[model samples]
Target: GRRALVAGVADDNGFGFAIAKALAAAGASVCVATWPPALNIFLNLIERGKIDDSRRLADGSLMTFERIYPLDATFDTLADAPEEIRTNKRYAERGDFSIEGLATQLVADFGEKPLDIVVHSLANGPEVKKPLLEVSRHGYLAAVSASAYSMVSMVQRLGPLLRPGGSFSSLTYMASERVIPGYGGGMSSAKAALESDTRTLAFEAGRKFGARVNVISAGPYASRAASAIGI
Candidate 1:
């Protein structure tokens, strides 16, 4: 089964959305894992038929989802979340919706191995507007954890959920290679680690799980988090 679970589609205009559309056009059943805060808005947009026309397949059919699940890559497991976040109104209905929770849910719904493609499109630079020298320790580290390690965490948890010959991918940026002004905090460092880990994970996951791991360093586009850069 060509079933894909794309994590991090905050909106219809992002790269994640494009990847989902392409997979659907190729006859793959698509499901998305969205950040909880954006999840409600995204579903509302779909319910309102806002992007129905744009979801058309090459064969003149509309691409649809198997289901959309709530996911927060920041917390690897439900137990990893803080008490405040656990009881927050936004997270109440998400149901232990972290990386590990998602893995368990997948198994419960689809079985031991159900995925053909797993895409990690998550990136959060909370202090993107601040200069590197002025960034707080917590903010800088948070950026790395959210933007880089989240991918690693996903691979570790989702590897067993992917079938042999399956693919695991994450989105990165050119900032990993060169110092881009206005892109400060630890965002660049995070992307660099993400690229580095991608190579290492390829070897580990390929050898252990028969899966291919890769990173796509796409250029800048106006995704939801773009405005936060204050560029």
Candidate 2:
């Protein structure tokens, strides 16, 4: 009825973009939440016509987004962020895209209206090429933060922002269930945590908010972020 907020779109070829376009074609307004540093580049890509939205659908129509927001989930509150993280090389360049920032922005713009769908398509594993035993604490935690805990944080913050019977989906991997060689550096563990939390959230959030929470365990696909991890 309203819009689906698809998060973690780095580019048009990613799963998030595909999902957004599909939702738009189905007559749902689509808004995207992209990593802040890449927000400008994403906007530029759309502006310069680098991303084509003119592919004929099965019913012969075009699709496009209604809005795009910058989103980062590390800090629930702007004040909780460390100065170093706020002023970090890449993060500093992007403005407020934190989870709280996005929530605040949505409330300011939509006035406490609930969303219909929320998609969580974000993940990261810094030392993905390394084995779990070889992974450092920072790398492991980073994977958990970006991949696993973000889902929990999303449900915590966005659950209230979702309408009754709204659907929430997050992307996981088969790695959560089965080990894949070279899928290392705690990536599997991150996915495991993600899957575990998905079920937990399904129960908790379903009871509390009358919403549906599920996860799609996606097969490996070639993506910029995936390629960076050598997947």
Candidate 3:
């Protein structure tokens, strides 16, 4: 049986959850990696029955998922993280859900097994509302780090955990190719970089690991993360 790991789910309303559900419906054991800070809220919503898991899809099929994991990609390992980032107010609240933490948990539970599929559905832009000219270096880097480079980082860290011929997919936006005025800050540039890196990763990872990498340019949808950018 195939196993899938989905990254970047904030809630059931997001694409990550939908993708996870779809994979589960297809009989794949699906695991999700939610943003660490929002993992509790996601669990609460599921526990409180706020989102219906039995809802029908367009094809009249029911939705389901296996597990959800906490993930924060800013730090690959707890030891590699600086004290300030570790002690930051928002980060401190999530406990140890960093990339290394999840990797450790996955290995502990699955015993060094290789995953069949990996989905990159995470993105963020702290200063998305600000114009590019007014965006600060920190905000620009944050956008690139969260939205674009995270995919590269994930492939670097998790690629070894994927079986040969495994498939990796990421969700991109049209903003990479066209301008959307309100989509300011360095987000557009970030998307462009993401698309470019996707191609590079596809070639490199495919050759080295015998895995395929691709990206989807999804149509605009009002997702929780997108709403934060007022898109």
Candidate 4:
């Protein structure tokens, strides 16, 4: 069986890492796509043996990743990224490491239909601490683009990359429905779009590629991702 690509895994404590751990424990080979800026840091932590104990399995043995790829889901293509970001020191080694580029890299590395599952645990809200009324248009749209459209873009790009009966799932929050006081900066709207696209993608992808799409509405946990709410 091919490996599952778990995108957005920056550290051991995030939902992405936990999901990857669960998949590996269930007998799935797991590969992770990490943001280029943080990829080196993550590698250093793993190499220096500074790993987190929370990632331990029930049997007590630590999990391992089959492979790691640099990825940034915010921009589908390199041309869309800013010049400063493209020229950054951390991103210099990774060529075209966006979602679109990840698909291309996977094909070159594993041939077509290489993934059985894609876990999209990516989300970013620049103005997450700002209230809706205080947020700028750019901030609101950025949240939607990163948190919602990234999933849609990945589904579109991975249609050929996913094996038959493959599945793609993303993480959402309860803020998509009932409003949480501090879940501001249009993050709630972003989750709403993510969930809506999940349902739509399920039908569209299932019909065309024999694939499935879904989003998990996760509750609050101590993962680094949840800390963005400024609690």
Candidate 5:
């Protein structure tokens, strides 16, 4: 069976959750990575059966993730993570959550060339409600780091572990090209960068690893994260 890893699934409402169920239906063993602070909440929702209905597959079987790991994409390595983040209750015992850490852990658990699919269904913008002109430099850079550059980091770390012809994809938005009021804090810029990188990465990763990279510029949907933008 093919194996897939979906990063940034925190709730049943998002594209990552849907991608996991779809992969399971296609007979793939699926794993997911959730932001550390949201990991406990997401697990509790599952354990309490709050998302049971969302787990149903097309074949009537309930989709189950083979594993769920803590991930904080802002940092590429444990060494890059600040001491405060390393010691946070949600993170302290979660083991390494960086992209490099994830790649190493996956290789250790499943051996080399273990993954057939990788999905980057992640986005975060701290000052999304503020206008772009009003967003702080800190907020803008943080948005780009978490929402855009993380994909590049992921591919850099995980590309070698992907089987030949493996696929990598990330979600983008129309706001990447067109202005969408209230979608501020450099999120639009982030999505634009994600799309631009997709083109270059497709060529680079394809040539180097025999893998493909793509992005989906999806229409707006009121997911938990999107709602914060008042969309």
Candidate 6:
């Protein structure tokens, strides 16, 4: 069976969870990576069987993740992580949660060319409540860093590990091009960057690694990320 890694799955209410379940239902062995801070909470939810009902597929089989790793897409490598982040209680015990670290860990656990699909379903904007004009430089860059450039970093780090012709996908929003009130904190700009980068990555990754890169701009959905935008 093909192996797939779906990153950014912090809860059951988002596209990440749905994608992971769909991949599993399609006969792929799915694995997921959650943010370090929410890793334990997510695991607890799973351990307590809180999402078992949601995990059930149309055919009655329950979705299962082959493995769950801790990941923080903000850093491409562990060395890029700040001391405070490295020492945080939630991250301290977790070995290398950076994108590169995840790639290395995947290689160690599953051998070379271990993945057939890589899904980037995560985004974050700390100053989402602030208007774009009011968003600070730090906040704007952080939004682009976590929400947009992370996909580039992921492909750079994980692309080589994908089997030939493997698929790499990320989620975007209409706010990238259309003006959506309350979608602030440079998130719209980030999504725009994500969409642009996807097109460029499609050509680059396809040639270099025989992989396909794509993005999906989903309509409004009451996921946690959307709710953060006052949806």
Q: Name the candidate that leads on lDDT.
A: 6
lDDT of 2 by residue, 117-170 (tens): 999988878788998879999999988998889888888888888877798999
- Candidate 1 minimal-lDDT segment of 10 residues: 222-231
Candidate 6 lDDT, 101-162, residue by residue in tens: 99999999999989999999999999988889899999999999999999999999999999
TM-scores for all candidates: the values are 0.96, 0.92, 0.90, 0.95, 0.98, 0.98
Per-residue CA lDDT of candidate 5, range 71-115, in tens? 999999999999999999999989999998999899998999889
**What lDDT is obtained when candidate 2 is compared to the true structure?**
0.81
Lowest summed lDDT across 10 adjacent residues in model 5 is found at 222-231
In terms of lDDT, model 6 sits at 0.94
Give the alpha carbon lDDT tens digit for every residue of 65-184 in model 3.
566777777667777668987787756776677776776777777868648899999988889899898999999998898888888878877787787679889998887898778787
Instruction: Compose the digit string of candidate 1's lDDT tens values, residues 1-231.
Output: 599999988678888999999899888999999998888898988888898887878888888888889998899999999998889888887897899999999999899998989998888888887878888899889999989999889899999898888999999888889978888788988999999999999999998888999998897777777756643
lDDT assessment of candidate 1? 0.88
Regions of candidate 5 where Cα sits further than 4 Å from its true position: none
lDDT of each: 0.88, 0.81, 0.81, 0.88, 0.92, 0.94
Across 1-231, the per-residue lDDT of candidate 4 in tens digits comes to 657999999888888988999998887889899989899999988887788575577888878888788888898988888998999989878888888899988898888878999999888898988988899999999999989999999999988888877999999998889868888888999999999999999999999888999899987778776766644
Q: Give lDDT: candidate 2, residue 128.
A: 87
With candidate 1 superimposed using the best TM-score fit, by how many Å does residue 224's alpha carbon deviate from the native?
A: 1.5
The ten-residue window of minimal lDDT in model 4 covers 222-231
Return the lDDT, model 1, position 106: 90
Pick the winner on TM-score between candidates 1 and 5: 5
Query: By TM-score, is 4 or 5 better?
Result: 5
